[model samples]
Target: MVFWILISFVALAMAALLGLILLRAHSMAEPPAAYDLRVYRQQLSDVDKDLLRGVINDSDAQRVRTEVSRRILAADAQLQKQSSGSPQPKGMSRLTVVLAAALLIGGTLALYSLLGAPGYGDMGLASRIEASDNYARTRPKQAEAESKVPPQPNPNLEPGYADLVAQLRQTAGERPDDAQGQALLAQHEANLGNFIAAYQAKQNYIRIMSGDLEPQDYGELAELMIMAAGGYVSPEAEELLDDTLRLDPRNGPARYYYGLLQGQLDRPDIAFRVWVDTLRQGPKGAPWINGIEAQIEDMAFRAGIEYSPISPPGAAGAQAPALAGPNAEDLEAAQEMTAEDRQEMIRGMVARLSDRLATEGGSAPEWAQLIGALGVLGEQDRAKAIYAEAKTRFADDTEALAQLESAASMAGLEP
Candidate 1:
């Protein structure tokens, strides 16, 4: 109520000032100059007196009288015209002033009431800065919590495979300088989403390489780090991506993750460009390609651009060598076991792979492995679930679907 009263008072004062201005303009119009015959008559009489007193000759007095008579006649004519002409300040009236004043105040107050903030209070500069800082400080805590939820591999794996892993662990422990053992451990650990152990094993492998690393090694290391960080490309992972790209610019994983890092660094243009190029050159079924495609569209949207990547070729791509339930040596050992033991171990292995893929999604090859394993185990329901999930995850990915389909057909599973 008090605020409204103050506004009303100020508005009234402004309206009054506008009214005064209009009235002053109307009143300030120049009034017609007063033209009277009496002044001219007085001047003519003075000239006649001067002549009578012998101050001027007759001809000079006549000339002066003629000029005075002309002035008096002109003045009389002007006064007559003025009486017939319009009144003073003819166009501007008092009503116009009132309307103008009312309009000025009414328009301003109406606009303010319509557009201005009527109830919002100011959060001063300091408070606003504090709020912004608090927001910035809170996000990492959420990310840290997510990263700490360690990935769980299935507990019920094959006893033989578990024994093999145990043997490998023993070998790696005994021969701590064995680079090959460390590398194998890293691959197996990552395959299981034991990212913490995978990271340790990869670091050991990196140390073994002694700064002589391949782009594939760097890319794999970056992947391990990102998985350990719950998919966030931290600065350390970014550096590994950088190293991967430096070694091989065509490295698919490096290019994709580098784009992600660029997006995180708020360089959407670079991110968009890198991801687009990666899509153009990448194989249709690369595990990272779907993620890259999504990120590209998102960055393009945010950068206010229209983006459409060229479709990947439909031709069959060169696939990596197949890795099934076990290697030849492990299979030979499994063949020595009793038939029931062999069947139980095979089911256990397949179950673990299924659990791993379901819990923590894997690469295209890993997905193939899980699908094939499920088919071999004759578990059609789980195989269908895996297929459905893979299809959903790689919705638009023709190459990945093709690979899974081939594996399904070979395993003689239901479509």
Candidate 2:
């Protein structure tokens, strides 16, 4: 109310100033002929003075007087004609002033009403941060967010595949201790868009494999939980993300979701930094890279960064990075070798691949293959080291990290 009063006062004052200027100009203005008449009368007075002082002869003074009198008459006649023809419209002038003032005041108020938040008070930076923190602290829980999401439609699926999924779910429910069955159930459930069921299956899998839980397991659970809540990163999902990142600090999915959580908490500054770093360490087709590319500009704006949009790597008809791996001809030749000889050849190939990777960086799949080959050779320490390095190398590529994690598990390392 006070703000409105102040704005109204200022607008009214400006309109009043304009009205005074207009009125003063109208009142002080004189006709051109009136100025001419005044000059002519002054000249006539000078001629009379000249005659009295005997500065001019009687005839000369009389001629000057006549000429001045004729000019005065002509000027007076023009002034009277002008006055009668176009009399100052005092009422119209007042009406114009009134309209102008009304427009000024009314237009100002109307524009403000349209564009300004009428009742919202100004917030300082600290106050805004406090409010955002409060809001984040009180945001909806996992169950509440899940409840608010509308039911998703069943995906179109082949009858054979659907029946298999249903049978898998029933079997997994019956055999609660079957870790492999639960993992399969979770995978299929998530594929069917049943994320709530998927996460529940994943929870069972994690419990059954508690002794062998991996960072990918926690990341998967968090992703399912977020999907269950229609992409809301609830507290439960955040906890899972924390676990994933604690186990593997460079986990791509965990970091991406953490960035998303920051954004939801109204901390775009942190979110922007996290996403920018993640996007920079990209294998072009990573899921998080696309999500970050789509939203990073808006986040940058919110965080007050002057950012220009960037194209994703391998975009615009650019060739994808070539992945180094064994060719089909090598596989065919290995097949013809005896078991002992094949084993020898495999060790030689693995040694060569490892040397090449050490000299020049390779794709995530090639790294995973090397880890798995080391595991096959019973080199546990080397496999573990390779797995760790692979995780760090492809830290921002979620799919690549998943593959690396799978290779790590197969390598018989503790999760």
Candidate 3:
């Protein structure tokens, strides 16, 4: 109520000031004809003074006096015409002032009501930060977030592949001690977009590999968990992100998700800073780069920063790395070879590519190909492991991750 009273008082004061200005202007203004009349009368007086002083001969003075008198009469007539004309009605003038005042106050209040937080008081930086912290501390947990998310539809899969996934799920569930089975189930479930099941399987895999866990392990689990919760950064996922960062401070995926967590917690200032730094430290292809680009402007606005969108370095006219795969000649050669020979040839190619990547890092497409080739050769476990490593490798590269995801899908590893 006090806030309203204060705002109303200020608005009314401004409106009254405008009205006073208008009224004063109208009251003090002199007619153009009145000024002309005064000037002509002064000229006639000067003519008479000149006649008396003999500055001019009597005949010349008389002619000048006659001209000045004619001008005075014309000026007087114009002044009389102006004065006799219908004057601005006092009521109408007052109505105009009232309308202007009403518009000034009403328009300001209406615009504020539409665009401003009516009751929200101005918050200092420290107060805002404290509020954000309190909000973060009170945010929903993983289970609660997951509960609020609507059920996602499973991806369309071929019958044979669907059956295989079903069998894998059953086998992995029955063999709780089998880490390899759990890993496979996790990969396949994720590929089928069963993120909840995928994350659960990942949990089992993490438990089994607890003694040998890497940052990427926790990062992957957090990624799946976030996906399962429809991108909400749950407390569990936040903890996983913390663990990932603790192990590898520069983990791109974990850092990106952590910034997202900050945004969700009403701390866009921190989120903006984190995302800006992350965007600048680019593999330009990082999976989170697009997300950052899409959202960072809004975050900056919320953080009270004057921000222009920054494109990732090398984003303009950037080309994908040339994929390392068989050419037409190799295809033709393979067509002529015996089935066993062809299989052997493919295996030889895969081996050479694998060795090259292991010794000297290759492009993301090459890694994706190797993963897919491994899967085709009945090496699902190796494909799954390679998929994980490839994701970690191109974590910052959105385009590379997209290519890797496509290959992973084809390899029946994960989505």
TM-score of 3: 0.73
Question: What is the Å distance of residue 217 in model 1 from its true position?
Answer: 0.8
The TM-scores of all predictions, comma-separated, are 0.46, 0.63, 0.73
Write model 1 residue lDDT over 1-415, tens digit each, in one string.
5565777788788878887776676666432423357778888989989998999999999999999889888887787666533344535566776777688778877887798666755556566555545643443432463467666657544435555555557777897776656766675666566776777787887898797666677788888888877777766677788888888998888888888766665557778888888888867757678788667778998657798766644443445443336666766787588656776776766776667767866766677777766654547677778877887886786667756765554344444
Full candidate order by lDDT, most accurate first = 2, 3, 1
lDDT (C-alpha) at residue 412 in model 3:
52
**Regions of candidate 3 where Cα sits further than 4 Å from its true position:** 1-6, 29-32, 39-69, 78-86, 308-363, 369-415
**Error in Å for residue 68 of model 2:** 18
Which ranges in model 1 have alpha carbons more than 4 Å from their true place?
1-147, 150-159, 313-415
Each prediction's number of clashing residue pairs: 0, 0, 6
Off by over 4 Å in 2: 1-10, 32-77, 83-88, 303-305, 311-415
lDDT of 2 by residue, 1-415 (tens): 7787899899999999989987876787788888898798889888889889989999998888888888888888888878633335788778889999999999997898899887888677898789888987888999999999998998964223455567677787899997766776787788799999999988998998886777888998999999999999998899999999999877767888999999898889999988877776664556777788888888888889998766545422122232233466866675566655655655677788888888987777788778866765658899888888878887887667767777666455654
- TM-score, structure 2 vs. true: 0.63
C-alpha lDDT of candidate 3 relative to the true structure: 0.78
Mark the 10 consecutive residues where model 2 has the least summed lDDT. 315-324
Error (Å) of candidate 2 at residue 206 is: 2.4
Q: Which residue pairs show backbone clashes in model 3?
A: 285-396, 285-397, 285-398, 286-396, 286-397, 286-398
Provide the RMSD of all predictions against the true structure, rounded to 1 decimal: 17.9, 10.6, 7.7
